[model samples]
Target: MKKVIGWSLGIYLVFGLFIAWYLFLGANTDIPAQLKGSPADPQTFMNERELLLSEEYSKIKNLLFFLSVPFEWLIYTLVLVIGISAKFRDWSKVSAKFSILQTAIYLFWLSLLVEVLSFPLSWISYNVSKTYNITVQSTQSWMKDLLIDFWVNYALMILIVGVLFWLIRRNEKRWWFHAWLLSIPFSMFLMFVQPVIIDPLYNDFFPLTNKELETKILEMADRADIPADHVFEVNMSEKTNSLNAYVTGIGSNSRIVLWDTTLQRLNENEILFIMAHEMGHYVMKHIYIGIAGYLVLTLVGLFIISKFMSFMIRKWGHIFKISSVKDIAVLPVFLLLISVLSFVSDPVSNAVSRHQEKSADLYALEMTDDNKAAVSSFQELSKAGLSQVNPPFLVKIFRYGHPTMLERITYTNEFEKSEE
Candidate 1:
């Protein structure tokens, strides 16, 4: 028994480290030369040869965005199967189940790793952009952006991970049940407080200045039964060139935030159309529905995990560097389970969100009676983000949360045609 435990422990540790190194080290090596940061002057920084290499890299990136998910899953499944098979004596019927667990761990760890390694990731991304003269500034600005990301993400994880672990340990297999229960209060608090607490950690916000824009936004809120709080602009432009706008908070405190980039890039009518779409989400009670969906799924996940808890802990427990059943570290395994559920559940989740976005679009179109403005907004988003002109169907299935640009354009054009 002692020997079995020791061997299991040894294998798990070796495997864990191998996985971590592969994810980080292997990923870094793949950074394309074109993706590396370079000087602003095309002549000074990248010669004609470098320019050609960067262009090739851009082609690869377009391929990468499509290929990344499948490539990741294949590697993930391989590692997971090997890890589980080495640990457990009988992983035949239970192999599929454990694979799911492995996938979950892969995603959570990968997500964290990506975030933790964002410094280099952003640097490479920024440098690549600079090499192509696509980026706005020097490599120093890229470092500052990376630093801000590192701190913001580190803080958010710390704030939530500790309590998340506590919840899993206290409930064990029923951790999902407890988490769902916890999420209720947490969701409420997050709605009311996250904008105040979490938002400020990364960026600053101030009341919107344009009186005409402010009045128009407020009127839309009133019609939608949303109260006026404070409309503000997030200072995201200072960090990166991406454009975004969002509605945050719940009830009386709910505020609309338009990125300064969004304001600059979009016209008043387009802005109003987007706002109306956001208002549709508020009216439909999507937030409340989301809370319910999370609770239900969590309960199901907890029930599944409860059935296999003992075998899991006994088999792969040593890799965690903990002995007691009560040790909080094992919660990572439970978290891995949630991660799997969340990933697998993306299609259903995306469908729900996509429906809400469509509904919002419909509401916006009706309210504004400006089909051209909605089309313009979509065009601006695609241009600003350099979004794929037409993403693959499989990519759409597992990844996108909203309708494709093609779909949006087609739908809006159909509406205009019907009107004509």
Candidate 2:
């Protein structure tokens, strides 16, 4: 346990230093010069100040993403190594006669510990966004949201852990498969209610008050064969300066939500194009595809984890203070495996998302028949968010779910040429 903890902490110390250098000393690094065609090219869409800010801003956010994954994994591993999970396991049984009650008790401490340990990264991310004027959410409100996030996820953890342990105890050998099958409905239920039930907890949503804009969006919806009668606008400007619109939910719960910031910042045509782009997802059934893909990945991931959990328990179970995969103490090991494997699978998932986003972009251009709006809306998006037009390879692979601004703009340019 000491050796494992020592090696893990040692690895992070070295990695943390490199991330520090990359952010501070290497802020001057022209990492995107290759993609941009030249360093600080004056001919770019953004002015000099915006370009410079985007470079630094994008780098910090992207680097933090890379840094946090392993940090989270380490925290999970440390808990198991130091017997925190074991301690919790014992504590959970002290008063709880029922296994479900014990599971909830153990999970509350485990979830709280994980959240507290991982919070510095969360704070650092918030601070960076706050410093850059990206977020307008007050520190008080931010903390409120954090607390809400904690409880919400805690409740979810209780449900998930309860189901998992029940399966493990009842069907030890095929528990992962059974759990994965159960998750299909559970996951879909979450998606279905997310827009109506989950999302409203964080922000207020209302029908687009701009009747003119609402009419335009509704008309576009009609043209696209989308059943949305109302376009919802959420008051996100209170929290962030960024602009966005997205399609969420399924069936009657389906919504194309516009951030109030998007309405405040972008013009009607840009908003229409953005709406059309979002509508493309519904028309193309991307949401269903995404959900299906998630289930498929879960099926595969859980299978691998089951195999790994069996092998790891046999070899290092004693070190982790757990005798078997069914042991409640093995929860941290389960989460750590998930974190590590999910990190490894990120590029593949992100690549698929990017492809779907590009398809939507093409659909928008065709629907709107306005390459100029498509291009300028992307430019406005990049400007408002201080987004990097061309990101580095690592960021592209791991962080980007949509095409970079440069790639998006290039597509419109190609469309314009074809029309000519």
Candidate 3:
């Protein structure tokens, strides 16, 4: 009993570190050209460097992400199988082989369960979109797109599981070592292919044609002493009414994208604030900080994964469709560990984001004098976007990128008070 617990704990810690090491440390970490600037905006330059570095790192992380899906199914199944089996017999006496068999069954069953769960939701989402007049495509086209999405995802799942399980069965002794090494190149391939390949399948994106809006935006960028790049508007309104704006790409392709909804709804003041917030993410280097933090966490996690994976294999390795501790199937455990880590680290992520948002709000306040209009912008967001005034704490923690409507209103009012 003591041995089992020790083994599980040990496996969790070491495997976690092993996973982290490759994701956070082994990936490329280069600086992007856009992020490079003079001393005036050192933050932008630093962020660019981190973003470029992450291009290499992201490849690793994406591969690890794909690798982890089956692993999690394995973990989920193993826990259920082992927990159920332990109810009937002395856990210490159960053969590793028998435990592995039960886990395989568990994995297959869970996959079926997931397919069932996903199908209904997917159908409902499409139906809802049509009801809202958000989708113009016919039902046949939607179904075809859904089918394509499913097959793409299903293929990836099969590949990850097949490779991970095969490796684990082949090398029960040194799986983590090989898995980490292999992930580096697999990650690179994914990065090279993703933007050009994967994303285009789902949505239409084209260059922006609004010359006046583009000119105004560029003028603002110049006034702020920030780089002026191309601006693009995505045909996002074709599918959904939700509003979003982002600054994407790195070198020559670096551009800003505003959703059609955003362009249609916002006045000049509101647009300026939205721009400031997006620019804040760039100027303050949030993306770089986020990537760096991810890399650091991954390195630490991989180190832990390497140290403790064997114990996990001995106990429930069968659940993951692998018999050896060295197998990459244990990547799921690393994910669970990171999820736990993220829960613990939520406050930190939120704090940094909130501070950046506040700074951007300040920037917006300085740029515009229409305080009531600024406050009204948020009110318009709530009303049009159907955002809640106040959300539950748990929901806020999990979902919100910005403060709640109530919080924003309070902040805006306070800012106005301070001005008077």
lDDT of each: 0.60, 0.86, 0.56
Cα lDDT of model 2 by residue, 1-420, tens digit: 789999999999898788767655654434345546432232456788887787778778977887898899888888878888899999999969999899999999998888888899999999999998898899999999999999999899999988998898888789999999999989888989999899999999999999999998899889988887899999998899999999888878899999999999888899998998998999999999998889999999999988988898899888777898888989887888888888889899999999999989888888888887887788888888988765766668778899877778877756742364
Better of 2 and 3 by TM-score: 2
Candidate 2: worst-modelled 10 consecutive residues by lDDT: 34-43
* Cand. 2 TM to true fold: 0.94
Task: Show the colliding residue pairs in model 2.
Answer: none
lDDT against true structure, model 1? 0.60
lDDT of 2 at 338: 88
List, residue by residue over 1-420, the lDDT tens digit for candidate 3: 345546665765666566566545654333234323322122322354443432333333333443343344435444434443232223322433453443444334444444564465456555644554445567777777776776676556555555655666777556555655665566555545654566668766666677777787777777777786666677766666666787665434455678777888888668766776666666766655655565555555555665665666666655544454443334445445555556555666676666667766666666554566667677666544444454444435544557765566556745743354
Residue-level lDDT for 222 in candidate 3 = 72
Considering summed lDDT, which 10 consecutive residues are worst modelled in model 3? 37-46
The estimated TM-scores of all candidates read 0.68, 0.94, 0.61
Model 1 TM: 0.68
Model 2 accuracy (lDDT, Cα): 0.86
Badly placed stretches (over 4 Å) of model 1 are 1-175, 306-309, 318-325, 416-420
